[model samples]
Target chain A: MSENHINISTNQPFNYCLHLADNSLIMGHRLSEWTGHGPMLEQDIAISNIALDLIGQSRNFYQYAAQLKGEGTTEDSLAYLREANEFKNILLVELPNGDWAKTILKLFFFSTYQYYLYQKLINSSDKQLSAIAEKSLKEVTYHLRWSSEWVIRLGDGTEESNKRIKNALDELWAYTGEMFLPSTYETEYAENNIGVDVSSIKIDWDKKVNEIFEEATLPSPNGEGLGVRSFGKEGNHTQHLQAILKDMQYLQRAYPGCEW
Target chain B: MILEKNISLKKIWQILEQITDPEIPVISIIDLGIVRDVHVDENNVEVFITPTYSGCPAMDMISMNIRMALLQNGFTNVKITQQLSPAWTTDWMTEEGKEKLKVYGIAPPVGKSIDQKYLEELKVECPQCHSKNTKLLSQFGSTACKALYQCQDCKEPFDYFKCH
Candidate 1:
């Protein structure tokens, strides 16, 4: 793995790859925060397992991105060395996990979005991206199912549970719109058929969300005002991302090029 | 040279057969369908393998074990390539491997992974008592490849290797 020097002016495909990789890395890190603090033992293991899967998926994308750059850039440098402002992940994943309800809702929304996105990405013009998407789609399928069930369980459960889940939804709903708003790299690659145009998948995402929300007895948030805090994909992020990067990158920053 | 290459290829396959999954020690890597193909050229050996799951921690260990196994067999120049295009599926798992899993107290995948969001009505018989009256405790288990299941009859908790 090459040491990550600041190459912010890289190609569109490279940026697109980082967008995908950063999403998984941050999402995995957030979920891993629940490893020792899950509500119960079984659920603890379950969420951690999912976190492992996301981290693994992020590794794949980061490795590919490094290979594309080919100037000694490695997955580790790409994951650990990049500045917070250089990250292209959506704001939804970077938000703090408010509670179990919030975490599950975030995962449900992201995975459902990924479900639709990967469904199209599997057919990407780039064979490697296609293969990665194909492999990831299966895992994301299980993620969507697990999170959807949790949403329904929380939304339709006891009165207290229902209230908590509703609060989570209200807190999280504003961030969901950024998922479909195409970043510049995304727009360019999608035109070439090598990347997914997220805007195209918004309808399918809405339909699935509606279906699950209905089953969970939760009202779906209207699409209006969803992107009030958008543009995370353009390297703009909330303050929470800086805090997350502080924890995730502390070791790498303190001990540069250190290996386990 | 041709005869030597064929011999090395066959020997490599046999050596791989001796390497079992690090997590599920009962099933050989070859039987589990992780070892896709092997090729030998002069003294160099290239092995093509696939990951069962993207984040499966066992894959790194499996690669290490393959290297050690090959090194022990005097195949010093060995390379392991990950082929991810045609993603791995449980359908490739050998019948013998499935039997080994059952005997070792873990239920093998029942059938093809439909890869749909909806849960399929797949019946997982308990390896302890051979009863299909088992309930899924969770979609995830001790590892990424297995799910936690408990038998109603024997009341024993076991791992079920999921179809994916």
Candidate 2:
């Protein structure tokens, strides 16, 4: 081994990557549901590509997580073997893709938050965390732009489109809070300068989201009355995640030693 | 002896960069920023790389290319390590690489930078006439990372590398 090599250990940075990767993987799984159901062929391809991108991000993170654990576990083993309660992804990612409108709205909100989160992570003190954030930021930027454009078009287009988009926003608003809550590992990483403070992202997220909403002439979903508590950071997920995990882990679970 | 090793390693690096991405022939794997680190230990040479996308079928080709490139460069003992931490992103593309894409007649990704939210919107400049008067013909283009666009002024269709 080279002198510059560092041992993989159970540290805040490792957990941070795990959390980030898990969020993308779960959300990607949800988005994959819209593969053939998108409103148009072009839209279908776009959403599916996004789903693939997120899954790619998740695979990268999981690979790193396995390295950190220094176990013989591979990415598939970590993703498939983990229990539903063990997943640390935010609730926003696990929500069902209700309709095209709902899916875009979900993407809009989540991508907005991810933009800021990854931006901060790029400057993390931990070299590994910073490197991942730096690389992922490029892909996430496109996701944000793609989703935001859809939100504006759908919200301001036909009356039916407007109504559908608005309803989607209303339904998905309750789950947004979980994105900003700092997990225990996040707190530790922040203190150690290896992770970002999730709360700091709120201002940027609100500003950008508000700008898009205004441009689209859509009313901001009144989250005040929703009163949804954050649960994702603490591994408390919605019922939706259970079903998602069941489907996602099916092949891996059924053929425990299978390799493709 | 140490200086001789460093010189040999540098030669190997140059040979490895000649391997182009199987999918995008215009850009080499090193220019794509997927090649992470290279190390030479005694008689063994190891290259660290990350995949362009997870489950990307092209990775198998990339691994094979590395081995072949090293063997051609006189390094018989070669190993490739795949690192997944810090997922691969387009931001890693070198400025020179972006220019190469433009010269190849494919529009390079345009934007301030990529983040999780709100990527910079780039109007597809005509790859032929360099005009901003372009309209998106379709979101799905030749591949997953491209969008089909037509330049109104030049009346030519081209692919825009969607910022991803």
Candidate 3:
């Protein structure tokens, strides 16, 4: 926020919530692309199931944000009507799912951050946010555990598997900086008890990532660009998000208020 | 208990108990613990329900069924509202529902939502042979609420209702 503590506007709150919802929405869309294509049948079910969970979380946030927005704007409108440049999700989520290893590793990093964030969120003074967090934290625990176990197995299991996971870690490590960086209204929302403390979650995220990487016998990538950060909160995204928006928002845009 | 209400609360409850969860058909919504509160304010009946999981797709169907069931039972103005606070937990599952799940070849959920540290250690008895030797095949299964496990003794694969 620099030296200026900007006044929190009313729309900023829902926009922040939109940020959370967009992250899950895009990540869910990316994960769903793996439907029937997982390396194994059980993993097929697992991955898609995870996609469903993420989408579900997005729905809850979108619904809340819609209510906060008032007027005829709805969760569907928010999800389907938004442009690529309008989305406030972190760039990491908007990135393409390159490979099975890359997908799992990315999910691992995101889930780890979410686990810690939601843990703090459950205690938030905002009762509605707390309730949503309380419900979401349970599912996220499984997501963290599920993805962590896979990361460990791939990183520690065999030479080929370990090599693949190692490559994945190197590729995805840069984007993690975005998760800790607070979005536009995040600082004020946290101060007012209406949002999460993302900065505080970094310590726990580091600890968990280190613990998991150690158990997996894999090296942790040096974060922070020498820890250089990226911005998706500012609507800056990788080239991949536009394509996702094209596909995801297509049905809604083309049909125009059509429902199945 | 009456505030100028024509229908009895007990009657509304019994009628609601007849509505089954769309996915897990063996258990009714009442046994599933989704029905949180049922208030009869004159002719209007407001039913508070909670989702079993964050994204249980059956919630809409469950709501519709509740409305139809009440309407058929002579209660016309029925309202089905969702309550997410105090999130739904497996602890709310009735004893009868657990037994029904076991008999239907799905191991009932074990452990508490708060005591997640014990999740990996929670022993699941095979619903098929009641054997304690069971291995988790996948943390997720056919539905969002279950996990796939294989029984060593019975050599049969079964669904274990995962502790939420």
Candidate 4:
């Protein structure tokens, strides 16, 4: 096979796996940032659980990626060794979790995309990919429902809460477009029915989001400039990912081969 | 001839179902989807198991329970093997287990039973009132695989079985 074809075959799955793994790892790390900073004790525990779930999902995807590479690369190595530009996650996941409203907004948007993505991935041609998708789709659905409800409550509640949630939506709106951008790797895998088509997800995402926004009495953001965010698939990332990597990879990097 | 083997397997299944989940006392490990296989060969019995999570603290307890159950049933040579591939998922939860959860006032998991994505999208019905108008009180419940939810109609907080 030509080098291009070989790259297309092998790296397609690898890149798709990385995107899935990175989404989980980055989102998990963001949730972990609220370890002791949540508004209440119960909410603190809740965020921690969300963090753990994401980390678990990341581990599953990373393990599968390692198997595909067939180089005995551990999940830790893939997670800790890759540079920010090498990561293939969407920018929305990498964005900083500014406040509770911002975090909720991010979760609502990401979970909606993930719910649809995994729904299609469950029917993937690859058995392992299908299994992972079959498993993760259940978790992401709960996450979407949880966050969507929060979006409604915060957006339609008190005047102050409503204003804060709206501000969060506006601030994070720029990053939403990256979630729908189909990468070269995704295109290749989608041809074989081994990966999901991002474009197809936008319709369901918009409908669900608009419904929630309408229920919350929040105005749907209207702007032609909304989808102009930098492309994360092309190695462009927000500054937040760099800071996130520093803390996330610290333990593995500090003491090599350290085991719990 | 074959009938005897079938009878023994059914008996083994019954014994296994009696083994309760260490973390959630109300449910059995068999219903929780941990026991994968059970086979008998002459005087030897083999039991295959998978953990809910890779490093779940309750695995030891589950193993001990299985051993004790078999020994008490006059099967002394029981071997338990752990299968890590095709990782265990919430989808393995039996229909009976799901119903038990609802009756126990915890919202059963819905959607791609194994995927976490479904946990985020599907509206968890109120365990107390069976209303879809329930809201999540917190993502974390008493256990790792559960979320706390409150019913808007009945105003009762219940646990939701979060997909792992």
Candidate 5:
């Protein structure tokens, strides 16, 4: 829970936690773009709640990461004060919210990954991370279910819906490779049971994605390394992330330490 | 700082009972079964809470309120630890809390915990008309802890504090 058990490497857990936080933060912002714009009124509210959940998850990680940093850092400072290049979130999360089909499919992909990741993380020797993962796993379960249901509905429904989901899968497939690309901390932390082995989740991720896509009659879009792997984990990102930060970090940049 | 072995957990409970959930406003933290543990240490009081939802944003406010309440009530040092094991379920919400939710126009959670496959098929009684004919509009609702439902009988939409 503190800086005590992490004998592997001090920066690993902090960096790991920061990456998780950044992913959720950016995903929350992406999901928020759906506010008041969902296909139906019920869906509008549903997406907002999912966004809130992601934002809240990010806050927990950020708060913990801030504590780990221990030099008077706080959640707001970590979330809002950081420059675009400094964030370590994978590229999959920061892409633009394209269409309803795109958003739902993207969400399905991420939620599936999170579901498997948290399933393993819940058993982490790092108690705080374990607790956070356990708690997050429950929420992600619902998210996976909701988004997967939509993917199925859209994929099997009609010609137009099917076409959109197929296109989304192709557009988003390349970005997901970065999720499985292992970090250096995994070898040490995985040995200590304090962190997840990202590679371990890859099989589950693929199986889950394949099954869902199979059920929906959509082919697996992860072509044979057709897309270039962007090192978004190390802060390289598309032009889209800067635009997101322009809006997300605006108030914080304009008014430092301002609270509502 | 003198160790207060005389401090009672019941007294701490009384203090906690005064703190309402920031989001619901209708339910106290105790009513939602969030106050999982209370330890009156020598110089400090430690409270363990489990969040109703993993990402419920109100947890911070609730923790702050708890600290403030205890500090104001003479406990100088208060510690709040969030626990996530055995994940918090709607089943943890007290029966009294469930009643209050219905009175507040939100449907009380029906099951002890979610059987995810069956969640969609479960019939929830409408808070407004108490109709079992209500249909689920969305599994996610106003908050992560709720689901949106529509009562066919009364033709009204309500928030269901979803089970788990």
Candidate 6:
């Protein structure tokens, strides 16, 4: 792995792939934090399993990105060695996991976005991306279903659970806007039929989320007025991302190309 | 790029059939439907395999195991390539593999993963007592490939190799 970061701007497809990869990697990392501390044994295992799936998906994307870069970069380098600013993940996934409700809500929101995104990506003109999308779509479908059930359970269960989930919805609603707003690379690739036009999926995403919320007996937070503020896809991220990087990149950074 | 043939493709596949999943030792990788294809071009051999799950830890081990198994069989030029297209589904698991899972105290996937039925609705018979009176404990289990379930009759909690 090279110590120098590869100039992602040189390659549009690479940037597009990184956006998808980073989202999964960061989301998977956040979910892995709850590995041992889940509310129960079953839930713990469930969250960990989901995390594993996301991480696995990220690996696929990173491997694709590395191949695209074709500059001696490997998936490990792309994942562990890249600076936080080089990441193209959306801000929503990089946010702190507040509570169990927050985590579940976040997973619900992200998986819903991914569910729709991968659906479109499966038809990408790019063969590798399409193949990856086809494979990952199955896993994302499972994730969306699992998180939806949890959201419904939390929202409609007890008073306290309902309150926490609603709070989670409100807290995370602001970050949802950026997912639909395409970055420069995304726009270019989407125009070429190589990447998903995220804006097109918002309606479906909204409908599914609203239906899930309704089933949970929870009122949907109004995301219409919440303008997109942060752009993690544009290499802009929250302060929380650096902290995540600190823990995640520590091994590779400290040891300088260490491997198990 | 062409060279004299050293081993038969049939012989290489016969070696792969001996390698079992590291996580689930009861079933061979061939029965699990992961070994997608095997191409033997003269002295070079390439095995194409697909992962059961995206983040399955066993894939790396499985790849290594396949290499070692082939190497032991005198095929030193083995190359393992992972192919993701068409994806993998539990529907591909052989009937013999499903029986092996049951005999190993694990329930095999009962229905197609594309089914709309809820986990509770799936009639996953208990591996221990072979009783239909079983309930889903969790959608996820000890690993990414399995779900947790318990038998109401025999009171044994077992793993169900989830339908992908």
Q: Using TM-score, give the best candidate's number.
A: 1
Residue B54 lDDT (model 2): 54
Error of 5 at B13 (Å): 1.1
TM-score of chain A of 5: 0.93
Candidate 2 local lDDT, residue A32:
85
Candidate 5 lDDT, A1-260, residue by residue in tens: 32322334663378778888998999989999999888887798888888988988898899888988888889888888777777888898999899999999989989998999888988987777887887787788889999999999999889999999989887888778878776555546677787788878888888888888888999875444325554777677889999999999899898987788
Interface C-alpha root-mean-square deviation of candidate 4: 3.6
The candidates, ranked best first by DockQ, are 1, 3, 6, 5, 2, 4
- Give the C-alpha miss distance for residue B86 in model 2, angstroms: 9.9
Report DockQ per prediction, comma-separated.
0.82, 0.34, 0.80, 0.26, 0.62, 0.74
Interface RMSD of every candidate? 0.9, 3.5, 0.8, 3.6, 1.8, 1.3
TM-score of chain B only, all predictions? 0.95, 0.87, 0.94, 0.87, 0.92, 0.92
Which rank order by lDDT, best down to worst? 6, 1, 3, 5, 4, 2
User: Each model's TM-score, in the order given?
Assistant: 0.96, 0.83, 0.95, 0.75, 0.88, 0.95
Clashing pairs in 2: A115-B116, A115-B117, A132-B86
User: Lowest-lDDT window of 10 residues in candidate 1 chain B?
Assistant: B113-122
lDDT of 5 by residue, B45-157 (tens): 89999887756878889999999999888888888998776678787889999999899999888876645653556789998888899888889877788888899999999
Candidate 6 chain A least-lDDT 10 residues: A2-11
Better of 1 and 5 by lDDT: 1
Task: Provide fnat values for all models in the order shown.
Answer: 0.73, 0.34, 0.70, 0.23, 0.73, 0.82
For each candidate in the order shown, give its overall lDDT on alpha carbons: 0.88, 0.79, 0.85, 0.79, 0.83, 0.89
> What is the Cα-based lDDT of residue B136 in candidate 2?
85
The residue-by-residue lDDT of candidate 1 on B1-164, one tens digit each, is 88888888889989999999989899999889988888888988899998888888899899999999999989999999988878888888999999999999999998786556235757899999999999999998999888899999999999999888
* Candidate 1 residue-wise lDDT, A14-35, digit = tens: 8888899999989999999999
Clash-forming residue pairs, model 5: none
Model 6 spans > 4 angstroms off: A1-12, A223-225, B1-7, B114-120
Error of 1 at B40 (Å): 1.6
User: Quality of candidate 1's docking, in CAPRI categories?
Assistant: high
The number of clashing residue pairs in each candidate reads 3, 3, 3, 30, 0, 0
Comparison by DockQ, 4 against 5, better one: 5
What digit string (tens of lDDT, one per residue) describes model 3 on residues B1-61? 4644534788898998898889889999988998999888878899999887877789888
Q: By descending TM-score, how would the candidates be arranged?
A: 1, 3, 6, 5, 2, 4
